[model samples]
Target: MTNPDKTGLKPTCREAHRLVSEGMDRELSFVERTRLRLHLMVCDGCTRFNGQMALLRTAMRRFPDEHGK
Candidate 1:
């Protein structure tokens, strides 16, 4: 289980995943970004997940335009 710091960031893997997913749709607050960054620094799984999400987001963005072409 991850620990919360002074900023009360939940800092858990679950929270990290939630933040990463949410960030895809909307901008996270400073605290949320900080917490997710800290978690990603130590958790390779979440880091990979973040990267995969980025790749997926990119692919999804291009999917419609490519289909139209």
Candidate 2:
């Protein structure tokens, strides 16, 4: 995870996952989204991870609650 600008933004798979996870909870900043996209473009593993996370998000949204509502 190398920080190209030393601004704490790591353009690596780990960082990409972090960004993706954070994005699920809140809107990522422009720089964060850009960094994550760039990383996903070059990393198949991270790309798949990002897709999987998205799928999980969608599934969770449609899941029934414990009360079975």
TM-score of each: 0.79, 0.81
Report the C-alpha lDDT of model 2 over 18-46, residue by residue, as the tens digit.
88999999999999888787787778999
Q: Model 1, range 1-69, lDDT digits (tens) per residue?
A: 534453464477778888899999999999788889988999999999999999999998778774576
- Pairs in steric clash, model 1: none
Cα lDDT, model 2, residue 11: 77
Whole-model alpha-carbon lDDT for candidate 2: 0.83
| Candidate 2 displacement at residue 48 in angstroms | 0.3
The C-alpha stretches of model 1 lying farther than 4 A from their native spots are: 1-10, 65-69
